[model samples]
Target: MGIVVIKLGGSLIQGLSNTFFEHINLLQRNGKKVIIVHGGGPLINNLLLKFSIPVEMEDGLRKTSNEVLEVVEYALNGKTNKDLVIMCNQFNLSAIGLSGCDNLLLEASLYDKGKLGWVGEVENVNTSLLELLLTNDYLPVISPIGVDKIGQKYNINADLAAKSIAKALNAEVLCYVTNTNGVLNSEGKSIEKITKDQVQALIESKTITDGMIPKVQSALDALDEVQSVAIVGENFLNEDGSMNGTVFTKGVVFSE
Candidate 1:
């Protein structure tokens, strides 16, 4: 097994069961190198409100000003990363928490200054540090704040960050550990497989609507660099080592 980049959504973190960690351990035991990237959106929002900072979003990206950037870092790095690292450690998994700025893991540029201030687009990912940690049997828990060449750190989106890292590492899968049970069809059941083109068509037909649009779009944007992407809920693993999720693969026939 090779590298598998898993992106844990902030909203779903609290509900993650012990079985999830067991699944991770099973993957590690079977020779799959795991890299975890996590988000803390809800925590960030709470802090923003506490500080009286106005929260805003532009196309699913947070609008980060200088003040808000501090709070973002506090929530993601100081709080979420710390808690996740501890969780992994409690499960006997050797883990270390790091930010995108650490060893220049993620190099980014300002996405849109006018619309989404201080938000970043992942210009590139340097996988050397990640490889080093994985080789040493350490799971790297990453927080998605990126740094620029001029030492400017911008708040980045966790989903895109995981995708970029997957590309750089040539990971087998970019697994989004989301709140939903994959993408749902019109019947409200999880579609086992889909193509990015099909996802776009579903969006056009309104079969995939509202919040699901950005999730699928993010997966689509990453397809050029990644071989496949998966969307799964927290309880994805069964006792039998099987998984339930929707996998998006290019140029492949769709099936259950």
Candidate 2:
């Protein structure tokens, strides 16, 4: 069985359906070891609002100050992580919640020279810890909160975190679970498959904008190590267990 890394976007978590969990179950039954890396943007924003902290973001990444880091940790590690773990268990999939700081699951260094305060980019992934859990048939639900060698914690972008883990593990597939169906064209229809060059063209045309920019970039970055990558919605799996989404590839011919 090969490994699959699924990045669940923060915005999709609360709305995830029973079918989504069932799809994950099917993947396991089909002998695909699964690892989930999740985001908590909305929840973190809510917590920040509750504390009257100013919400800030640079590009698609959150600008995490020390105060913001505390709320991020609470929302991501404390709430979102456990919720996903419980959902997996309810669906009969054994899952364990984890923070990147736990056992240094994700070791990181500052991103952009600390321009974004506590924001970080992954420097290492604890593959041994992940493999141990996966070997025992336990799905790992990880939060994108990384720690440094000096015991300092930082907020990592979930998409990038998933990419790093997938690369480290040489995963067979990496799926980004987003709110939209997939990458949309000017007509707002899902494009079945896209290549790297085409992706840049779309970006230039402004068809792919904002947060999608980061997600697609992460997919391309993961392509160096992963065999397959897709940006999919909650109902990504079809009746035949095939994926239904915008598949990202290296130099394949495009097909809608």
Candidate 3:
């Protein structure tokens, strides 16, 4: 009766297929309270290009500046957030779009003081507002953006944002929705499942490097607090609209 928190990546939200919405509808039918945390890299990048703003990345982490933060908030909160809400409302689901900035729900610290600019890492999550939304059966669609105590707005990584919320809410499940089918090896084969120890091994070997490295690490971290953390394929939508992405847990594996 708790809840499920899904960290839907910006890459997926760039254009989620109808199949995804169907899966969400199914989850709602089953009386599951799902909160969606989203990112908007694609949209933000497009805007940056149009404005002739130079974009930069190191280790897949975007370099945030005041210029980039403006575009990020516009895309993530304005476009991406509302689009997901509209999609759910089409299925008669009550979806309320919001950003982490609302009510200071998410407090953050600059990811890198001298280099990362306004790219902030979550420091604390205020669950009171979210809990109120869920108690009323409203699916809270969230954009990962927050402001610091000094009123400096920061763009948060969606994966970490969702993890924080899930832990705060003591959610039963945390699913990370990405474009890929799931965790893949160097051979580009989907790894149905593996133990946390195995995941660490892959990380050590650099098999799971780059952006994916943080994702897997976050999943493992969530395991200690949440019931389960899954990295699933976006295509795994249920017939009734529930999510069907591949799930990862303690030693959970599926046959390819």
Top of the candidates by TM-score = 2
Give the least accurate 10-residue stretch of model 1, judged by summed lDDT: 209-218
- Give per-model TM-scores: 0.91, 0.95, 0.89
User: Mind giving the per-residue lDDT tens digits that candidate 3 earns over 72-147?
Assistant: 9889889889988988788777999989888888888888783878888888888889989988999999998987
Q: After superposition, how far is residue 119 of candidate 1 from its true place, in Å?
A: 0.8
Cα miss at 45, model 2 (Å)? 1.4
Most lDDT-accurate candidate: 2
State how far residue 217 of model 3 sits from its true place (Å): 1.9
After superposing candidate 3 on the true structure, give the runs of residues whose Cα lies further than 4 Å from its correct spot: 237-246, 251-256
Error of 2 at 57 (Å): 1.8
Residues 17-129, candidate 2, lDDT per residue (tens digit)?
Answer: 99989888989999999999999888998989999999888668889888999999999989899988988899988999998998999999999999999999999999999
Clashing pairs in 3: 22-241, 23-241, 23-242, 24-241, 232-246
**Could you arrange the candidates by TM-score from highest to lowest?**
2, 1, 3
Q: Report the Cα lDDT for candidate 3.
A: 0.81
Question: What TM value does model 3 have?
Answer: 0.89
Candidate 2 versus truth, CA RMSD in Å, comes to 2.5
